[model samples]
Target: MKKVFSQIISLVMAVLVLASTVSWTVDKHLCMGRVMDISFFAHAEDCGMESAIATLDSEDYQNPCCEDESFTIEGQDHLKLTWSDLDLDHQVFLVAFAQSYIDLFVPLEKLPVPNEKYPPPILIRDIHVLDQVFLI
Candidate 1:
């Protein structure tokens, strides 16, 4: 369960990074203060009001009622970072962290076997039987 949870967390983080690095744009066409069309990958369709306004008068042409607006979401352009980009303190901390992480997995030296030099005492009789120790 712990392993699965970690994998899911890692996947979410990867997706978050990918989403933050992606860029997109939203194009919207408004006619008379009302949205006419909205598009993401293509240009928004106009309401054909600009052509009608232009044909009304040749010399005196006012601004058309329809407007095209675009909203751009810019993502990170510099995603590639090198080790040298880190400051001196950060580099030291990273090195120390890596060293400690590696050390955590290192097999510890085997402890000395307990009582390895001691010899077992010889028993001629059963101590519990000789002592008349009985449990009800």
Candidate 2:
């Protein structure tokens, strides 16, 4: 009885370990900034291969972000990037992950005062921010 109980516990533990180690696959097709199709898969090789082979290629998709212009940043220096330079996948990746790069020399504006009722206590205009002033 003791040995049988131990075997049952070991089988249950093995099954739990196997279940925890299973991998899942997610398939998504996006067009025009929208998800057109989505699918879930337990087996990598069996996900879409069988279905795709069974069907004929009949879909033609166009990217909505495609525009005829050189998107450039100007101020500190001239930076130019054209649609031809980056592919659809890379452009999408850049839009999703890359940070917006603003030109450093683009005219910096002072923050607006929150309360207009009171005048600014100190006028910091045209002063070197790093200079230290000593009060006598």
Candidate 3:
């Protein structure tokens, strides 16, 4: 009876820990309440490819793409995407594989941005190579 009771207690404690960690991850890394006004999806659209790459790299909600208007002050730290950021072929690849890249980083429903009721078709068939490069 004591063994059974200890096992049950351990299970409950494990579940509670898992739940709290998930909640904390969603709140902190994903910037849940702080950026509620901005939809992650729309923000992605506005930020585009570089933002996609940044999101994949950080796995957090740090405005992967920022423009002049995106900040209240001028010269605010922001991701300035240039062709130099990625090679020519990679630039084309970014367009080709953007949605897949995003899916790897964030769930569709969790995307902070608003969009069409239906989800878009997945474009990139496989991202094994990209996984090696970006998701290290």
Best by lDDT: 1
Kindly list the per-residue Cα lDDT of model 3 for residues 1-136, writing each as its tens digit: 9999999999999887565544121111223223323332123123244456665856665653343223221222444668788988998888879978877876466545666577997967557765665654
Candidate 1 stretches greater than 4 Å from native: 47-63, 109-136
101 Cα displacement, candidate 2 (Å): 63
**Model 2 superposed RMSD (Cα):** 26.9
Ranking by lDDT: 1, 2, 3
TM-score computed on alpha carbons, candidate 1: 0.62
lDDT of 3: 0.53
Residue pairs in collision within model 3: 39-112, 39-113, 40-112, 40-113, 41-113
lDDT (10s digit) by residue, model 1, range 1-136: 9999999999999999998988878999998899999999679988888877778857676765788999889989898989999999999999999999999998969977899899899989998899999888
TM-scores of all candidate predictions against the true structure: 0.62, 0.21, 0.18
User: Weakest 10 consecutive residues, lDDT, candidate 2?
Assistant: 66-75
Q: Estimate the TM-score for candidate 3.
A: 0.18
Q: Root-mean-square deviation of each candidate, in angstroms?
A: 5.0, 26.9, 33.9
Q: Model 2 scores what on Cα lDDT?
A: 0.54
Cα deviation of 120, candidate 3, in Å: 94
Compared with the true structure, model 2 gives a TM-score of 0.21
